[model samples]
Structures are given as C-alpha cells and as structure tokens.
Target: MRTIGVLGALLLFVEFVGAQTLDSAQVSAIDKNFWKTSLPRHELQWGVGCPLLEEFIIYGMGSDDLSGDFDRPHNWFDKEVYRGSRGTTLFNWSFSYLYRVCKFLWVGADVTYIGFYDVYYDKFTHQKAYINSDQLLTFMPKIRFSYLNRKYVTLYSGISCGIGWVIHSEKKEVNVVTNWAFQATAFGVKAGTSWFGFAEVGLGYKGFGVIGLGYHFNRQNRQLFKRNSL
Candidate 1:
C-alpha cells in the first residue's frame, strides 16, 4: 500500500506541473499574448519607438574643409578646416510600426525628421548652432532588438537608412530641388510607460550623436500588408 500511494503522488505531481502557466512575458517574446508585433522581422508588436541616440551621415559626409588659407585664430579656440565641409550633428525621430519576428527583434521604418546643428565652438564664439537641412522629411527603415522584453519597457538597439524627396518651402528662403539620400548608423536605449512616451541617444554618420523623445503608436484601424510608407 505504501509503495502504491507514493507512485500515485508522483503521477499527480507530474500532471499538476504540466498544467502550470509558462512565463508569458518570456514566452510572449517567442510567442504572442495580448500585444501586437514590431517591424522588419514581421511578427506582431504594435507600439511607438525612437532612436534616443544616433550619429548622422551629415557629419561624415564631408571632411572639415572650409576655404580660406588665410583664416587664423581670431580667438583662443579655432579648428583647422579640411575641405569645403564642416561638422553637422543631427537629431532624429521615428514612430513605432511594430512588426515582430520574435521576442528579440523588430523591423520598421521611421518618419525620419532631423533637427540639424553645426558642431563648432571657439573662444571666438562659444555657441552651438541649430540649422535646418534643406530636406526635413525623410524615411528611415530601422531594426529594433530587445534585450529583455518587458511589455511596457524594453532595452533595444536600432539601425536605419535614410532617403528623401523634398521641395523647399518659403521658410527655407531658397528653392532647393532634387532627391537626397543618406546612409546612417544609429543605436540607443528606450524607456517608456506606453508606446507613446520614450527616449533614446546614439551615434550616426558625420561623426555626431543624436537624441529624441516621442510616443509609440499602435498600428490599428489599418490594414495588414499596408506596407511601410516611403
């Protein structure tokens, strides 16, 4: 009787253990629960995201060369010019289009807008400058990978590419015309309550870093296979 009772208990324990719930958070990364998807990988993650940190190509696009061999230090701090180019720093933002491949990865494009700043300081002028790129509305296709998928908060890294079709506005004061495309590298962390409020910082091209904050959005009331807009 003792042997039989012990055997029965062992069987009962196995049954109970098998019926227990798996950690849905961990599993939801690999599987899916209530939330949606993120992009590139093309699964289901719907929320907003941004590149809190990034470097832009504008800085690296040219070597620091401004004409004038006779230019000298009018102040204590002056940098030598290389070519016809100076440094450009940029800030970027992208709305969330969560197309998930799995728990660890997402791919989508950002409606990549930039706040342009020139990076130069001097005893001549200890001031930073913010300039507008001739092209402001561009698209950046990005990939986000989460280190730990914490529903409301996840640590992620993003890389993106840029392209633009722009017609200058009167605010620009010049009729700039043509197609512009930039290839950039960026990575940053995000922290948020919902998809709507998050921030990040990372390096991009042109030897500069960028930071931005924006809300994440759900891809709802919209059709599947709608495709990322250019």
Candidate 2:
C-alpha cells in the first residue's frame, strides 16, 4: 500500500506541473495578441541642418539673368565683383509631429525655421552698406512611409508642402522670397530602441542634410511585428 500511494502522488505532481506550464503558455499568447493590436497614435521628432549649403541654388533659381561672374565662380560665399562682396550664413531647425495611420504609413505636420545672416560691402562707397538677418518660418503638412522597420534601424521617405513666412529686419531684404514652399523628396535612416537618432536629406524646407532624434510614445510600437515572440 505504501508503494502504491507514493506512485500515485508522483503521478499527481507531474500532472499539476504540466497544467501549470500550459497555463503559462496560454497567458503568453494572450499578452502577445494584446500587444500586437495596440499601438501608439502619435510620435514627435526634432532636427537641425545647415541651410547655408543651398543658398546659391535658392538665389540662382529666382533670377532670369546671370550675365555677371556670379554663376562662373562656383563659389557659395564671398563673391566679389564690381560692387563690394557679400557673405551669408544659414541654419535650419524643425519640430514635427506624426500620427500613425497604419503599420507602415504616417501623416503629420511640421514647423521649420531657416535663419540666415548676410554682410554686404559697397566698394563704390568704401563702406559696409548693409548687415541683414532674417528668419524663414514654414508650416507644412507631411506624409511618410517607413520600410524595414526593425528594432535597431528603420528606413523612411517623406514629402511635405506648405507656406513660408519671411521675418526680417525692416532695414534689410532678400530677393525672390518664395512664400510657397514644397519638399518633394525626403529620405533618411533611423536607429534606436524607442528613442532614436536619424540622418536625413531633402530637396526643400532647409534644402538638404538633416540629423536629429525622435521618440515613440509606445515602446511596443518600435517592433515591425509586435505579435512575434520577443
């Protein structure tokens, strides 16, 4: 009888352990499903870039005539001609917000600022003629598509169109300030877990080359497929 009782207790213990293991598996599956279906609705990012690189392109686009040496020198700054030379510096920064529409797409908006300063010299008068500083503020609505959305890195491209307002000192001015602006192409690579760093380039908004950081409101949203075993 003693032997039989010991065998029965052993059998019962084995059955209990199996049941517990089954319960744990079921719980894990449920958790996975819950996470897979839920995601964050919004994200925010900030970036900075050098806008001065595009100064020549921006100015050249506006003028119909460039008979002078301005086009020949291939120089971005310090162009000296019949008049005294002029020099410029620019900086770009932006804050953007995004709302996830689905797994791979997002629609959002951004506000970008391009700040520039110029020094002008008039050789005819042998004097510093003007010092001009201005800021261009642009508000744009953007759409983005993300690919290879993995935990470590993601690739993305986007486009934006909007209006820009030029804010300048009353004493100074710029030629061909295009109030209507459009960014037809923007592409970048991002890396991180939940908080990320990115390097991007685009044709508009500060012209090209952006580096920045972003954070996802939900940690689970970082994974491309959340339901998969982690």
Candidate 3:
C-alpha cells in the first residue's frame, strides 16, 4: 500500500511540471508574435490638411487694406473709395520622418508648406490694387507618446514647436518674415502593418484635422535596401 501511494504522488508531480512547461512555451510564443506585429523603428508619412488657423490670419491681414486706403494720401477730389478684399488658401501639405526610440515613444521631424493669395480692390471704382501671394514653410521637431499600442492600431498624442519662414510677395516687392510655429495633436490614430493609414485631430500649423498614409521599415531591411541600391 505504501509503494502504491508513493507512485501516485510522483505521477501527479510529474504531470504538474509538464503542464507548467507547456504553458511557459505557449506564453513565450505569444509574446514573440506580439512584438513581431507591433510598431517598427522607422516611418515616413505624407499628408494634407486644411490650414484653418493660417487662413484666418491671412484673411485678417487682407482685411487691413479695406480699413484704410493702403497708406494713400487723402485727396478731397478722390471719391470715397469703398475698399474690399478677397483671398484663397491652399491645403497644407506635410512630410514627416519618425524614429521609434522605445515601445511607447517616437521622435520625428516635420516639413510643412502653406500657400495663399489675397487681393484688395476698390468696390466703387471697380479697380484692383496690388495682389499678395504668400507662402509659409516650417520645420518642426516633434515627440509623440503612444497611449495604446496594439498589433494593428495605435493611439497617440504629440506636440511640436519650431520656426516658420514666411515669404510674402506683392508685384516687385518681396518680404521674408521669421515667426514661431507649433502643432499640438489632441488625438491621433494609426492602423496597419508596414503600410498604414492615419488620422489626427490637432491645432496649429498642421491644421485641425489630418489624414495621411505612411510606410514603416526596420533597420535591417532599410540597410539591405541601401546596399542593394548601391
């Protein structure tokens, strides 16, 4: 009876050990798969968005001419020239390069361009004044923090601050102004694997809403491509 009891206890211990080993192996496999499908090290993205804030600023500047007579000398003979203005804003275009430094953090740089044109006219005389065409180019270094990271989706928020070069041209006169530029994303979501589509809600230079496509590659593959190209 004692011998039988010892055999039973040994069998139970061996089975328990086997089960633990199997569970550990399965867990390891799952972890490997999870990391394999997550975010990569390098990403390149291009996008277009409406330059809402910039539009407002440009329009405000355009309206300044309507308030007064473009610094014209007031003449008693000059008819009360009612002034008006019109402008058009192009969509903002951006390109970015990002490097993932850790599981939840990324650093990147963005290049953006915004273009618009404004014209002031005399409403009564039906005569047009000078036309102003302006362009804003910005380079910003940015950081992003991922709050939710998954195999096929990621949710994040980011901020960027930098300087912008404003090129203003009117007829033969050209002016360049250096100014502050920034962007703050409240919510951003990206989906897919090597090729992805993303959308963001933000404020500042990038605009209020953005949608774009991106491609991601690992360091080894990138190096291989460089070698093959050479």
Candidate 4:
C-alpha cells in the first residue's frame, strides 16, 4: 500500500511539472508574437492616383471663351463660332515619409505632382487650335490615424493641407500660380510587413482612389525585445 501511494504521488508530481512547463512555453510564444507584431517607426511610400481634383481645376482654367468672332469672316454662314476643349489628366504621383509618433498615430509629409493636357478644337472643323499643359506640385504636412494595426494588415485614415504651385503652359506663354491644396483620406488599407502595398480612398490632391507601395524602416531591435522581455 505504501509503494502504491509513492507511485501515485510521483505521477501527480510529474503531471504538475509538465503543466508548468507547458504554461511557460505558452507565455514565451505569446511574447515572441508580440514582438513580431510590433509596428515600425518609420515608413516611406510612393503612390499614383487619378488626378480628379487637379483635372477639374485645370478644365476650369483652360475652358475660356474661344467662341468669339473669328479673325476673318468665313464664306460659311457664321452666326457664332464655337470652340470645344477636351482635357486629359495624366496622373497624380505622390511620395511621402512618415514617422510613427505613437501606437495609433503617425505624422508625415507628402510631395505630389499632377500633370494635365488640354486641347482646344474648332467645333465645325474639328481642327486642334491650341494645346495647353499644366503641372501642379504640392508639399503638405500630413497626419494619419491607424485604427487597426495587425501583423499583416493595417487600416488608417489621413489628412493633409498645404500649398501647391501650378505651372500652366500654352503656346509660348508660361504662368505660375500658387494656391492651397489638401487631401482627406476617408479609408486606407495596407497589407504586408517590412514591404507592403496600400490603397486609399480619398479626395483632393491625392485623388479619389490611391494605390501604392511602401517600405518600413527601424522595425526590429534585439535589445529592445530583450528589455521588454525582462
């Protein structure tokens, strides 16, 4: 009976030790995952988006009243000659650098360029009369709020406001205009780690929809992990 009692005690002791070991292993795994999922401190991104806002402004500026009386009266009955203008927006290119200020906040600056082409044609003849090209460059300070920061996916919204320089060229004349510029991102999603692809739905200089690639820097540090573990 004593031998049997000893055996049972040994069995219980073994089970207890095993449970402790398993618990330790589980805690270690959780710690490792926590470190792995930590956010980076800095990021750089490059993106391209449709220049909807830029195109709208360019069209307004380029669509002047070219439908006045012609330089010379034509044989054809000329009531009021009408000129038609068409505009093509190339794209909005943006590059930005961001610094993580807190767990759910980031601050950054963005540089963006928008290119547009406009052509005016005679309505009756369909002959191209004038060509105008516009280039808009903007520099803005930006702020982002990250709602979800996961290991492989992140969701954020952002806003930026600053000044833009518009260079308008028509024939031999060049004009430079400065104006206020802004972008507001209602939704944004980023997928990946270290290197990632992102998409943003927004308005203003960045366009209505933006997609880009980004790289994270200062992501990992062994010393920091060790300190946190302790």
Best by lDDT: 4
All candidates' TM-scores? 0.41, 0.60, 0.69, 0.68
For model 1, residues 169-221, the per-residue Cα lDDT tens digits are 32235454434443232334455533333434343321134343444444531
Whole-model lDDT, model 1: 0.42
Question: How big is the RMSD of model 4?
Answer: 18.1
Candidate 2 worst ten-residue window by lDDT: 76-85
| lDDT (tens digit, per residue) of candidate 3 on 1-230 | 47744654464445445545554665656673443334477889888877877776544555443346556556434444333554544578988888877655689988888887766555566677657688888999998766566768877777788988888886648998898888777678899888999998877688888889998887665565688899
Query: Which scores better on TM-score, 3 or 4?
Result: 3
Residue 160 in candidate 4, Cα distance off native in Å: 0.3
- Report clashes for each candidate as comma-separated counts: 39, 0, 0, 0
On residues 165-228, what C-alpha lDDT tens digit does candidate 2 reach at each position? 7666523445435577655344578887567888876667755778889887775544545657
Model 3, TM vs. native: 0.69
* Clash pairs detected, candidate 3: none
After superposition on all CA atoms, what RMSD does each candidate show versus the true structure?
16.4, 19.6, 16.7, 18.1
Best by TM-score: 3
- Tens-digit per-residue lDDT, 1-230, candidate 4: 47744654464445445545554665656663453337787889999988877887766655465355366457346322344554554669999999888655689999999877666666667777677778999999998776666778987777788999999997649999999988877678999878999999877788889999999885464457677999
Model 4 is weakest, by summed lDDT over 10 consecutive residues, at 75-84
Error of 3 at 46 (Å): 0.8
Distance from true position, residue 92, model 3, in Å? Answer: 1.2
lDDT agreement with native, every candidate: 0.42, 0.63, 0.73, 0.75
lDDT of 4 at 38: 74
Query: Model 2 — TM-score against the truth?
Result: 0.60
